[model samples]
Target: MSRMNPVLSFISHNRYWFVIIIGGLLVGVIDDNSFLTRAQYALQIKNLKEQISMYNSQYGRDEQKLNELRRNPKAITKIARENYMMKAEDEDIFVLSDDETNNNKENETTE
Candidate 1:
């Protein structure tokens, strides 16, 4: 029996716009074709590619080292002696630091 205020009536009648905007935002989030989803996919792909390149470089270095070891018996022996702490029965090994030798020379000169 009473006419509503025009502003209130217009807002009440068009309340669906709020629901439409919220629904559109939700749909965009769920759709992988959206811009944000595409950027995330691209970043993941780039990170995987960088990891692959790093692995390939490390593998290449290891392969080169393996080839060198295969070609040189002396290098293998040196590596074994240095890294594995191997010693020949006939040889006496003394480990000395260059700093100590330098300090000894300096002491001798001062004395």
Candidate 2:
């Protein structure tokens, strides 16, 4: 077999080097343009503003709920009974599971 010349090998591989050169040119353009940077900054600012608006809306709703809870005595008692599970002074609380109750009724009929 004959030996290949270096110039001929390089000419054959020129397409790969051309791709690298073009990729470098594209990176240089993106890095040099202030418009791309400014656009990215504006998008970040808009996202932050949306997050702040959402937080403000949630905060206002929570504040209104807190104020209503403070002003009303019966509402506070109801909330405490439901959330904290506080019972009245003379009431029997029966905890029933829907599945277990149905099974008990079915077995009672069989017996």
Candidate 3:
């Protein structure tokens, strides 16, 4: 009687299991639309959602500021004076130099 090789006998016995494992690995890792790709896409979608929510909140704040500017002349004037450095006809504007502002920041940080 001839003795069969142990490796060949083991493989024949577990051929189905080997096929299942290889098929699973191919589906999960080697396919174009695999589990890893799906996971990466899900993470990208989550990040995009967070960015969208942040942008929506910023848009809401800008919309509220626009409404306030439209309804109240005082708010418009305040924004112009603070942002554009505009002055009234009889008002004096004391503009701080960039150096002065940087010095003030340094002093505040030191304090």
Candidate 4:
């Protein structure tokens, strides 16, 4: 009778365990749909949640500004003057160029 090599005998004895472990690893880490791959989806969900929070905060701020504008004529006039270059009939509006604004910012920073 031939004696089996010790390494071969050990491998044969544990073959099922090896297959189960390797198969589990393949399904968990190497498959297209896997727990490891789901980590990316989790990160995407986190980013989307952060964006939703940011948008909600921005919406709240915009809603508050809208309510203020609705209630206050002065706020409406301020927004119009800042955004639309609007002025009263008796007032003169001086529009500053972008270069002038940048230079003013530089001067302020230097000071």
Ranking by TM-score: 3, 4, 1, 2
lDDT score of residue 65 within candidate 3:
97
- Residues 13-111, model 2: lDDT tens digits: 797787887777676556665567768889999999999999999999999989999899888889878888888999877766667444434656676
lDDT of 1 by residue, 32-111 (tens): 68768988999999999999999999999999989999999998988889998788889988887667344434556676
Regions of candidate 2 where Cα sits further than 4 Å from its true position: 1-33, 94-111
Which structure among the candidates has the greatest TM-score? 3
Ranked by TM-score, the better of candidates 1 and 2 is: 1
Off by over 4 Å in 3: 1-4, 97-111
Off by over 4 Å in 4: 1-11, 97-111
Clashing pairs in 4: none
Model 3 agreement with the true structure over 2-109: per-residue lDDT tens digits: 356877888999999999999999999999889999999999999999999999999999999999988999998899899999989998998766663444345566
- Backbone clash tally (model 2): 0
Deviation from native of the Cα of residue 94 in model 1, angstroms: 3.6
Which digits, one per residue and each the tens of the lDDT, describe model 4 over residues 1-111? 135587788889999999999999999999988997899999999999999999999999999999999899999899989899899899998776666344434556666
TM per prediction:
0.58, 0.50, 0.74, 0.71
Better model by TM-score: candidate 2 vs candidate 3: 3
